[model samples]
Target: MKKICLIASLITVFALSSASVNAQYYFFDGDYYENPVLYEAGVSVNAMNSLTDLGGKKGIGEKFLKDLNLGYTSISGGIFFSVSYKNAVALRLEGTFGKVSSDDKILAGINDAAKNRFNRNLNFRSNISEVAALVEIHPMYIFVDWPAKETTPPRTSPYLLAGVGYFSFNPQTKIGNRTIDLQPLSTEGQGFAEYPNRPIYKLNQLNIPMGAGVKYELSPLVNLRAEVVYRKLFTDYLDDLSTTYIDPALFDKYLTPQKAANAKILYDRQIVKVAGINGKRGTEKNNDAYFTANLKISVIIGRERIRR
Candidate 1:
């Protein structure tokens, strides 16, 4: 009787191990796991913020997050399409459009480190449009969950993404009741023969997008994701403000009389122009950057399942 009981226990252990192995090889519900390729499409809404030379922390100016101001945050949205293999890797193509703005007027006070910026009195708003191709890697699938004997994909997955993108922007400022485009005014001597080094900055340029996010499998056919992505830009003129203030006369030489008039006021909005100080317009050391926090919903659009 003792030998028979031992044999029964050993058989039970072997059977359970075999069942776990088989579970990994099959999708209990259907052929979703057997699918060799999966396709998804989605849309996202985001809150956009700028890290430019204007509008920064309340006191001293700083770099990166220290200068972030939610007062200038704007709305943005986009759509994306993706293809994935075995839920481990994905390639996504996406396009987004949004607006970003900054104003120096918000920083006002005597004896503050930001007083210099407040006195400069510069401001701008821009429309940003971008398209990118990104690669996403799911480490959980590769390292932890792929071998699990689960009948479904993991409910949550963390991912990392990096991509290349092309974007366009046109910076604008308001003067009186009228709105003005800054590039043509050459407010800082851009494209001026007098300032040979200050070449025209193209409205369109390339950017690098990098960030991380987590995705939740809401259902077999749907997923939800929350992500934050920062765009690395090559140009410092996103707000049409970079480098020191040019001689006001340069504007009249390079632009029409009407534009020159607007440039003077738009360039120097200071209540009282302090004499003997060559004004600094914006910091040239750092290029502008923008980021977005997005909530996205995606639906599986197509799949190719392997035949049993």
Candidate 2:
């Protein structure tokens, strides 16, 4: 009877110890499944170019100042914040503001000529600002366990992102010492007798931004990322500088003798009656597109399970 009682007591102690060990291990292992959140910020650069023609005479403008070449490539830096869940999905919001301007030589000659014609240069310099939002998906670790190897520490998984963006831009050009005074292509004939002095351009535009990028974990609480994106805009007058010849009859009506003296301005401003200023000429189309590259570092703000 004594031996049996001793055996029963030993069995109960062994079972209790085993239960305690199991509970401790379960708590340690199950913590990561709770899901963690992350946040990030970064900067980007734009490699931009404009595809358009010198409305007047192509070679003439090329020899002097390239009208079609009036566009910009600039470094635009901005802050981007994201909220990530499960380490596999995130929502990112970003706002960027920068000045993009073309080289002055691009329209120097045209500006000089416009000054001579209208008593003030009709040529101008342009600038723009941008903003965007996106949804990201992490694929590498969606189903895989972290701290991948027993000897390795846990790290962030890789991901992909795609989304749309909206932008509001104010396009303005500088003419002489005064900016935004003369309308682009607004005047008719040798002088500014017929055209309006207000700036010529559609001031605002909505654009579509879409692209993809990758992210990698640098540490338990830090990450590195890079991405490339493209923006497709709705308007063609980003440069706000184009020219067409004045009609001979209209020239006679609008221009004084001094304004009509320069025939080149009239020739350049002349457009087919069917295709008015800013009108589509034949198969030609006007739309603008640009590419951007970005680099960012993210810091994990929420709970991250530490594996031992």
Candidate 3:
């Protein structure tokens, strides 16, 4: 009986020691799954472009890459702050700045079906700035970046995001040495007696932004990310080409002599005008859209448990 008691005591001590070692190992190496919520801050630079009725290749093609018009790409950046929930979900607020531009004159050989656009010869560039609150969901929420561990999650994981934002845009055109704002010109006879149906488009509008991305855990505190986000804009005048042309007489009747002269030149730069009251200045089939390809880096800021 004494011998049996000794054997049992020895087994108990060994098991206790093993459990203690494992507990210490996980604590020091970040191998455990339950983590305190973390706060992170990030910054991103964007390559921005748009697909309007203007300069892209005529055929409807790739949404992001194939439709990319390099000439119209603009460099942009944004700052973001996020609260991450143990590698599962992150709520972030980000603000971005970029520019988008296109010119119908950039592409040649307008088909018979597209001749109206060829003769239209419209172009515009707009400065785009937006602020959004987005939620990022990680399908594979497990992150295994630490060394010396048997784990299932990979170093990188894909995520999806959707959100709403408010944006401001002002479309401009270059006529010789001067830059002109297209909105005030009322080229489509907006707010005029002849075309009351066409109202002045507001410069600021709402947008639905959605996209997918992948993030790579580069270190305990840093992550490398790439994402493509597209915005569905409420306004179609981002390119300043959204409606049919109006008669030159309307501008003269509505504006001062000098202003009317500028409108005539800026409204349409076409070499030859298609005779009609409402020429195809732009396609009304769809609203304008823009997208950004982002390269970002995020640094874990506060501790796992943020103190209120």
Candidate 4:
């Protein structure tokens, strides 16, 4: 009976020791997921470009990045606040301010395929202000090897994001020394009784933003990131040129005399105007889009909790 009690006590001691060791192991090396909430704030500098009807690379205008013109790249900036879970997924609210412009004259004398665009003589610049809510997923974070506590989340992570955004733009063009707002001119006879099929587009619209990026931890509290986000827009009028040219006389019937005069010259800037109604002003098949490449710096905020 004494021997039995001694053996049982040894077993109890061994079990207790194993449990204690496991708790310590998890506390020191495997508690990365303990935090339910994490906060971060950041700012970014961006290079902006637009895929519109105005300017493009030589050849017939292509779709997406193939038609990008480097000369028109502009600068933009943004700020963001985010909340993350287990370092694997994040929800972010971001605001961006920027300018985008393009000029078809860039394609002048490039090729026969680009002649029509060069002769079109359309150009525009617009200020962009956007607010977006996005979800970012870090796939690599879930596969972390967790070799040690200090290296659990790794120093670098690649992420993809998709979100909806609200943006406003006012397309403007320079005529001589004067800047003209294109939307108010009803350039394509929009909202005019003569062109019942064409409706005026809103200056503010919703867009879908999707992109990928990579982040590197510069320190425990700071991170550096680079990303390219493409905004898919639903309107072709972002550059103030879409559909066929309206007869100049139509402007007189619908607009004030001063506006009518301005519209006549701004709507058709070509040296040799294409006669009649079928002259294509801009391609209507695809909507316009813009993209930005950003370099960002972020700081982690809020207290971190260590699991017990």
List TM-scores for all candidates, in order. 0.86, 0.54, 0.80, 0.86
Give the per-residue lDDT of model 3 (tens digit) for 1-308: 34334533544454344334322121212433324355668899999999887777655423445655678888999988766654667767788998989877766685654455556678888899888767789877644433235453466879999987778899888879898888888877877888877888999887889999998978667889999999988877788777787888999899878778888888877768565667667766678899999999988743332224
What are the Cα lDDT values of the candidates? 0.80, 0.47, 0.74, 0.81
Candidate 3's C-alpha lDDT?
0.74
lDDT of 1 by residue, 55-78 (tens): 787787788899998999998999
lDDT string for model 2 (1-308, tens) is 34334533544454344334312111113443223444454544444333323232223323212343434545666677666644566666666555544433344445443222222222333445555556677776466544344323244445666665555554444433444422222333324444443234455555666667777667545677777666776654454443443444554455455444332242333222343443422111545444566666766554447575
lDDT of 2: 0.47
Model 4 ranges with Cα > 4 A deviation: 1-34, 144-151, 303-308
TM-score of 3: 0.80
Which candidate has the highest lDDT of all?
4
What does candidate 4's lDDT look like per residue over 1-308, in tens digits?
A: 34334533544454344333312122212323323345679999999999999989888889888999989999999999777755677777788999999998998777678888888888999999988877899998666634344554567899999987889999999879999999989999899988887898899888999999999978666889999999999999899987888788888998999899889889988866663575788889989999999999999753333647
Which stretches of model 3 miss by more than 4 angstroms? 1-34, 58-68, 109-116, 142-153, 303-308
| Shift in Å, residue 249, candidate 3 | 1.5
Clashes of 4: 0
Which RMSD does model 4 reach against the true structure? 13.7
